[model samples]
Target: MTPFLEFDLRMIIVDRLEKSYGGRTALKGISFRVHRGEVLGLLGPNGAGKTTTMKILTGLIPATGGRASVAGFDVHEQSLEVRRRIGYLPEHPPLYREMTVRGFLRFVAELRGVPRSKRSAKVDRAIEQCGLAEVAGRIVGRLSKGYRQRVGLAQAIVHDPEVLILDEPTVGLDPKQIVDIRSLVKGFGGERTVILSTHILPEVTMTCQRVVIITRGSIVAEDSIANLTGRGEMGERMAITVARDLDGVASTLAGIPGVIGVDRAPGEPPTYHVSVERGFSGKELLSAAVVQSGCGLLEMKTVPETLEDVFLDLITEEHGVAA
Candidate 1:
């Protein structure tokens, strides 16, 4: 007999979820999902509906149309249950500046409905997990911006919810602080589901397993980072740099097998952007052709599209310009 499976693989689901504020639509039927133990990034510019989507998922705000669910509980119909299964750290975390870190987290634990007996242990675990041991007894207001952010994260996870939603978790901190906070966030994957919403592209590139890009209150793209940046409709892009500036380089590369077109990067002499046809894996052929033509091949590497590239393309196409 086969082994029994008890847990659902998908931890969160948003289906055609829509929201409006007064007369403005904040989300235009956006939809996505987060699987168990996965770190998904929600990326967009300001007023792009990332926070709105997160609000709907966390039961902080109701969606005007469609539906969302967390841990198999409908966000609208089973809000309390949904809230119980998720932890949220908004752009500005709810914190009492006068309270010490330990006291604040203990308060959050009690408010989250942890038993009196288990509250200390829960708070301790959260403090440790968020690297707040040194500042546990320090007043929240007295702590550095980085430590305060950690405290905010501690409070969010104090109850050990199945999912964590972090909005701009590293908005205003020093470079070191950003690195430390990023390390902390990166450690949450594979044990708990996380939905990180931020305007920082490098954060998503370094931390998330997959990404969903929203623009003008709608989802413009969603895919694993590799796929989003690697394979395009035209195929992969190879950046070839030659030591000598050979005339007719563009035509020469375009004639090679699997080569679709070629263009020169701005202000980058002797370096050409070669677009390959779909399903083509002929970087070697392209490189050999360049060398055979007597153009000294300095560097040849596949240039995967960056998240910024993908984001600008989608948002520009959607609104006819950057948002």
Candidate 2:
């Protein structure tokens, strides 16, 4: 049975987590939580502690300090219990290339503690769930990279664990393969708690409900995709086209209250990009301004802020580093 979609019930928790190697500090007291039956993306640039956090959570390595738990079991103190409740897919698929797809899944199911009598049914469910039924008999080494990823995912889910941790699940996939895997992962909501770690921005937008952005071994931002992109101080952007192409058109639009900045692109029908306060209504004000200014408003459209834009803005704001 799947867990009901409950925000109050947290499935994973990390508190004041720190990690180090030799003289390098990898993670600096990062903290976050994943709700039960939700998809959370741990996003960051390469070497930004995304994988390091995943490794620690999956009990693959020891954390220098702090605490982490999955399904209420401490990752370090209750390693075996934690592992039993979670399915982990690292950056690289740990597939026995020599074994057939079906064989590899059976092996993984057995290793994951599925009883002998239940192994076959569990394996069959995983195969069908991951769209691997067609290639179940093919040798894993002979299958394409896309198929290999499917096998890896199927193996992770064979035991039907409550938590699924995926590190760069679509790292080496082609466009179609990426889309296919995204569709598969997107279907997992409400049935499992998923932590999808990746540097790819679209992956988070397409598959996750919330995100934890890490940079230089620290947590910079954590919130729902809507709140992160919608509540920024950057405000709403607009593109206003003027048919008259009059001088001072930029100034005219800029004079409107709440319109912060305006610039005209070079052309006959000049297009002015206008920046306004986040909650301001721009259409009527802009239309009236352009009409009064005699610039002859042709068209005005809102420019939306995407997750990528928000990510870049956050990275630049947090570290003052250009993206």
Candidate 3:
């Protein structure tokens, strides 16, 4: 059967994908899609089937059940075509430590079937984009950890495939290298379909337009960061401060219609965190409720929910345990 996204504009699609090793299942019917030119993140904690999903999409492993396609080519039956269309960077880079940076990229380009006429130009462009020109002549084995990472990135883009899949691209790097690699990853997003598979929350928040959150071999949530932060279970929240800490001040605000919960923060004037249900236009209502209760409304400001909070909340809610 033709997949819905196969005929549409989506760059990749996975439907009911499953994988197992002997008795342990790695992925349990997890599914998601990535649109062309869109950056999507497969986010999860360690051992959450994220890597399994990437391997299947990249044709490095076979899914025991279900269907997955990239660029309208089946991953199982058309792996060669899928590989030709995708440039993947696994968690630990596959590097020939004995080769020079330029030589290694040239070799990768050759392996990926780059035409002899354009191979040098492609290799040079990848080197420049990954900031590896300074070490183009350096041996991969002798380079610093950061430099080796740059080499990894250069090789991934050396082929310039239609889709780019990076699995934990920034792992094992220091803070500065993390920042540098993130900049390169950001640049690659809009030019092609990029799937960033990582466990780090900041990685998704900073670069991805949408996220697929998975845990325990199952997908728990998938949506744009904005939707998850503003409209999800946490809902719309506001930060409020009152001039005086009246005895019934907490109860007064809690009495307001549509107010879900009011929490007090540590401060002189007594600050309150007011959370409301979805579709509740409680800004003016909250202000009026505060004043009518005989308390001074010193301040009121909207506070968008953090991704960390939403991620933890969804995971914990799904599993009925601490995340």
lDDT of each: 0.87, 0.88, 0.88
Q: How close is candidate 2 to the true structure, as a TM-score?
A: 0.90
Question: Looking at candidate 3, what is the lDDT of residue 52?
Answer: 92
| Per-model TM-score versus the true fold | 0.89, 0.90, 0.91
Kindly list the per-residue Cα lDDT of model 1 for residues 1-323, writing each as its tens digit. 11122247888888999899999999999889899999999999999999989898888899999998888888888888878778899989889999999999999999888999999999999999888998899999998888888888998899998899999999998988888888888899998999999988999998999999998888888999998887585577788888887788788788877888898886655789888877777777787888888878999888777778888878888887544
Instruction: Give, for candidate 3, the lowest lDDT window spanning 10 residues.
Output: 1-10
User: Which candidate, 1 or 3, has the higher lDDT?
Assistant: 3
Model 3: per-residue lDDT, tens digit, 178-212? 99998888888788899998889999988899999
Stretches off by above 4 angstroms in model 2 are: 1-8, 244-246, 265-269, 281-283, 321-323
Q: Which stretch of 10 consecutive residues in model 2 shows the poorest summed lDDT? A: 1-10
- Clashes in predicted model 2: 0
Candidate 3 has which clashing residue pairs, if any? none
Stretches of candidate 1 off by over 4 Å are 1-7, 255-257, 281-296, 321-323
Which of candidates 1 and 3 reaches a greater TM-score?
A: 3
Q: Which regions of candidate 3 are displaced past 4 Å? A: 1-7, 266-269, 292-295, 321-323
Candidate 2 colliding pairs: none
* Reference-based TM-score, model 1: 0.89
